[model samples]
Target: MEDKANKAWTDLIQEYQIDNAIKQHGEFIIQAKDIKKYREPRLMAKWDSSESLPTILKKSDINILPVSRSAYVLSNFKLYQPFPENDINTVKYVPPLPLESIDFNNLSTESNAINAMLITGILDDFLGTNNTVETFNGRMGTNDFSFTVNLTNGGKRQVDVQSAQLEIDGGFENDDSIIIMEAKNVPHPDFHIRQLYFPYRLWCERVRKPIRLVFSQYIDSIYHLYEYEFAKEDDYSSIHLIQQRNYSFQSSAISWDDIQRIIDSNSPEIDDNYDDTSIPFIQADLFTRLISLIEQLDKVPNMTSAEIASSMEFDIRQASYYSSAGEYLGVIERPLRGHSQLSLTGIKLMRLKLRERRLELIKLIVRHNIFHDLLSQIIDTGEFPSREAIIDRMRRYNVCKDATTLYRRASSVSGWLRWIVTLPDTTEEFE
Candidate 1:
């Protein structure tokens, strides 16, 4: 049986087709279930007798015309009105604790993530405010309230928010206005607009002062804050980013020379008997990108693979790849099958000073016999070897046990080691 949402969607499709009153507005997707149905043997059998599959599909109730196996559009689909595009202009500012010289020991004691942001003084600079600040947390209203939200499918319906709990990570009421903030340890391409809208509405109803919605993120050891506002008062989806700024403290935690020294010290000792199929071989570089992901896990411990994927800007497969890389590095662990959580080593790294943290992470990788050997070869040869070289190197040790598995792990080996060759310059300006 179809669920309520799918059934309602079917009903909408039927009504529009029967009435010939389709509105070419709003965003909609042909549900995956229907797409799967179209792939059935019975459905494929009819393809030869009929016109092209997309032609037949257009006449059906699904209301989508397939452009390809992975692309499609509603029969009368029209693009949703897009918000204005603005350049993300940034002003560089210095952090109070040279971002590089952060004392992880002292920072670990701070229980509140918001306070930690404040102490860094980056928040003050980002907000353009040095006034004393006050924080708020917990529910904002005494009674539940019902509201309506515009759906992407060209519809609106009433939604009941119970207690409308307003969990503000960092908020401050200044003399002129109140700033409501949502903070994250890692950056994302976009966040659910409701993170700011719900509080904005609740507080606007309670107080006469204007509310400023701020989204703050800590990525690459820098604090980035984006100010957003709803262009339309009642439309939740109308949220727009108005301002963006980033700040970083001084950092010299790792250098090219440091990476070289570590790579040279750890020579590749082939462990032919080592079975490493449990972990994936790296497919992407950008070690700092992976570190930002680790920082995200540190912020929210024990997230399932799906949740981690949903929280990030990338696709689910990419999320799986990055998480797998973390697992191979031993910085992340999956205690339960299919569910990933930070390992003790990861937790310790999060608590150590920046320089110590960088060095320790290097030590962890170099200590691993497989990785140590790979890095040594990369540093010694001064170039990335061909895929065949990686496969040949792994074959000597019988790592991964089979050619297919060995090939996959080789991708990881080359992908991860590539980061050392192209580490980003930390001293350069950042936003």
Candidate 2:
């Protein structure tokens, strides 16, 4: 899907001599009609992350920003900002309402997650307010405004907007402030600043009260909300994080005893014919991200690698790595020519509720002798094994032969073990 957009943008760039235009005038304005000559402007221009940028734009360090309903300005400006690592130690707020109506386990979209947050009073608790009503949401036209964005060339340029399109995933307001939210389900390292900035600037022009920009991400049954503020209202480069909180309705407290129970009662026998080379050794970490990918596949099955990359806002190689990790877990199936789909085991796992689903996944992961043995040692010694110890175990299991590969694979082993150990309700460090 992204490849098509890349090629179309490449052609459009050449046809319009965009490189020359920018060199001469500091920036170039391209109309939606001009972009539609090859591909839909919406598809070509909506890059929400640095990894999702078209090849041509990425190579030139150029980003596109909409200046009006029909036009976009292309320039070499820093447009994406990184999200700070979430504090895994944050408190999880259990909503006061009963969990009967909203099924936290089956939230499939950003809208569903946001609605769930609102219903459960998670939003209220995070915002430090009691009376937050859903005041505005969805797409709306922005009033004309001007802002300055720092260019990649160490200079600044003033950009004027004329009623550009702005979309707010959710907006809640009380007496003193309006919270403008942009929500996402898949976890990305960074996001395009425009998603929050446009709506914020528009509201600032129209509202007498303060406007707060909030970015929310739903991953692995947790709602991570970040509140940001622009230090200089007219400067797009001034976005900064003010506060962040993580919440989950379901219990995430998994102790060593819980893991021991699964290990003793449900550990699968090591097959004599099991081949270590049958699937790639698990190199992908971020167990939460792996769960996120599985949930995405469960909701939209048969997604191609490019589609997955685009939706997850990661490069195609990272997409392939996560998919391969999924395959190794027996949760994802990839065909030779078609898209990737969830396996039968994945379907069954997804059908379970939040706690049950996590436990089931843990069970699946520990099915291997390496994980099972490592976990048993952790239970016995109450200490995590060192990298050298893990590498030695991999040697015994014939997991891989190359020393460099062994080290890379050992990190994944350690990562999964950390994930399992930290599942209990306690403050732990996360990489």
Task: Report the error of model 2 at residue 147, Å.
Answer: 1.4
TM-score of each: 0.51, 0.83
Model 1 — TM-score against the truth? 0.51
Indicate which candidate wins on TM-score: 2
Once model 2 is optimally superposed onto the true structure by TM-score, how far is the C-alpha of residue 39 displaced, in angstroms?
Answer: 1.0
Best by lDDT: 2
Write down the lDDT that model 2 would get: 0.83
Error of 2 at 313 (Å): 4.9
lDDT of 1 by residue, 1-431 (tens): 11222344445456445224334433243433554443432222111111112332334422322222333334332112232221332334454544454553233221244565666555665666676376675545423444455543566634444443345666787666788887765443345455576678777777887788877666555556678887876665567667776554535335667877877766544253556455655553446567877877887898776677555544345567778778867889888866777898889888775556777777776766667776667667776788898788777766656678778777766755664444434443533
Candidate 2's C-alpha runs over 4 A off are 93-101, 256-276, 282-285, 300-319, 367-422, 427-431
- Per-candidate Cα lDDT values, in order, are 0.56, 0.83
